[model samples]
Target: MSRVSRDGGQVLPFYAAMMACLLFAALAFVAVGMAGATRSDAQGAADAAALAAAREVRDNAFKGTDLLILTPEEWEEIIRGRRFHTAGACAQANAFAGTNDATAECAFDVPEFTVSVTTNGTVGDSVIPGTENMHARARATALIEPRCFLQPATTPPPPGGGGVVGIECRDGTVIIVNPSDPGPLYKLARKLFVVRLTD
Candidate 1:
C-alpha cells in the first residue's frame, strides 16, 4: 500500500466542475428550446385563427342574398372582392384559437382578418428566472381574394325572370348558373374566394 497522491484530490474537484458546467449548459439549452416551442405554438394559433376568420367571411358572402336576382353589377362587385359578410367571423377566429390551446383577439377590415393569440402554455421551469411564467404571443393576418368573374349573359331575361350566366374562374373553370337550378353555384362559393394567411 502507498499514500494517495495529492493530485488525486485535485482531479476530483476538476471533474466536479466539469460536470457542473455540463449540467448548466444542458439546462440552458432546455430553456431555449422550451421558449422556442412556446413561440411556435403561439404563431400557429394566430395563423389558424386568422385564416379561419377569413374563410368564414368568404363562405358567408353568398348567404342571405338571392342568387337568382344577382345583377351583373352586383356580381362584378362581389367578384371584385368588395362584397362579403363579416358576421360571425370573429367567433370563428376565437373558436380556432381555442382549438389550438390559445386565446385570440380578432379584427376585420374589409377583406383582411387580423388575429392575435397568446399560447396557453408557458416556458415552464426554465433556467432563466421568471421564464416559467412567460407565455408567447403572436399575430397574423389573412386575406380573402376573389378568384372568379361573372360573364354576363348576352340576352336579357323576360320580365321578373333570371337568366342563365357563366362564371369564369381563374383556374379556367366555367360555372353555368341556371335560374331553374342555382344549387351548384351556391355550393361553389368556396371556389369564388381564395382565403390565405398573410404577414
Candidate 2:
C-alpha cells in the first residue's frame, strides 16, 4: 500500500505540472491572438488613411487650373500625376483614420502618399506584461497613377484654333475634352488618375 501511494503521488505532481504548462500556453496564445487582431486593425486603418489622402489629391488637383491655356505638354504632366498639391490631403488621412478608431501621420511624395497609423485602443488585458497599455501601429502607402495621356491631333491645324483635345487612356478608351468647358476636364481628370494601395 505504501508503494502504491508513493507512485500515485508522483503521477499526480506530473499531471498537475502538465496542466499548468498547458494553461500557460493557452493564455500565451490568447495574448498573441489579441495582439494580432489589434495589428490587423491598425493596418486596415493605415490603408484607408493612405488611400483617402491619395484620392483627395487626385480629385482636387485641377481645381483652379485654366484648362484652355494648357499645352499638350502640360496635359501630359497632369496625366503623369504631377501638378497636384499636398495641401489638405493629410487632413483627409486624419479623418479616415479617425473613422477607423485610429490616428494617422501622412507623408506625401509626388504620386505617393504614405500613412502611418496607431490604434486608439490598446490590446486590452492579456497574459503578456505591458500589453494592456500597448497600442498597435501599421503603415501603408497609396499611389496615384495616371491612366491617360494627351493624344494630339495627327492632322494639320485649321485656320481657326482647335477647341477640343483627344486623350488616350490605358484601357484603349479615348476621351474628347473641350478646353472651354471645365465640366468635362474635371470629370476626365478623375478618370485619368487612379488611386490604389500598395503592400
Candidate 3:
C-alpha cells in the first residue's frame, strides 16, 4: 500500500511535467505561426508600397515632370536613367503601407527604385513570453521599363507609301528616325516606359 501511494505521487508529478512541456510546445508553435503571418503581411505591404512609388515615378515622369526637361545625360546623372519624385514617391509608399497596417522605414532612394518597410503593429497574440514585441520587416523593388524599342527603317518605304517615324508597317514593323534627328523621337521616347514590379 505504501509503494502504491508513493508511485501514485510520482506519477502525478511526472504527468504534470509532461503536460507542462506539451503546453509550452503548443504555445511556441502558435507564436511561430503568428510571426510568420506577420512577416508575410509586412512583405505584402512592402510590395504594394514599392509598386505605388514606382508607378508614381512612372506616371509623373512620363507625363513631363520638371525633370524631363533636363537633357538625358543630366537626367541619367541625377536618377540613373529612372526619374522619380522623392517626396511624392515616399508619400505613395506611406499611403500604401498605411492601408496595410505597416510603415515605410525609407523612401524610394535606391538607384533602381527599391523600398523597405516594417509592420506598424506587433504580432500581438504571440503567446511566447519573450517574442511579443517582435516586429516584421520586408523589402521590395519596382521598375519603370521601356516598353518600346525604336528601330530605324533599314530600307525606304514604297514610293509615296511611307510617312514619318511614328508610322508602323502592316507587318508590326515600325520605322524609328535617327535618335539625333531632333524631331519626334525626343518627345515620344518618354511614352515607351511601362511601370512594372521587378522584385
lDDT (10s digit) by residue, model 2, range 1-199: 6999999999999999999999999999999999999999999999999999998888887877777677666677777877997788999999999999999999888798999999999998977899999999999999999888777563212333466777788999987776665474546768898889877
Under the 3 Å rule for N, CA and C atoms, how many clashes does model 2 have? 0
Whole-model lDDT per candidate: 0.83, 0.85, 0.64
Q: Where does model 2 exceed 4 Å of error? A: 154-162, 182-186
Per-model TM-score, in order, reads 0.90, 0.90, 0.68
**Candidate 1's residue-wise lDDT over 1-199, tens digit each?**
3347777877899999999999999999999998999999999999999999998888777778665666667767867878788899999999999999999999889799999999888889967899979999999999998888876544323335567767888889887766556675435678788888879
User: In candidate 3, what are the lDDT values of residues 1-199, reduced to their tens digit?
Assistant: 6999999998998999999999989988988888899999999998898888877666554344332234434333322335444557778888999999998955454434677888988877655765667789999887766544323333322333342234233456454533234244324434545556677
Q: Which stretches of candidate 1 lie over 4 Å from their true place?
A: 1-4, 152-159, 184-186
Model 2 weakest lDDT span, ten residues long: 152-161
lDDT, candidate 3, residue 47? Answer: 89
Which rank order by lDDT, best down to worst? 2, 1, 3
Question: Which structure among the candidates has the greatest lDDT?
Answer: 2
Stretches > 4 Å off in candidate 3: 65-87, 109-111, 125-127, 154-191
Sliding window of 10 residues with minimal summed lDDT for model 3: 156-165
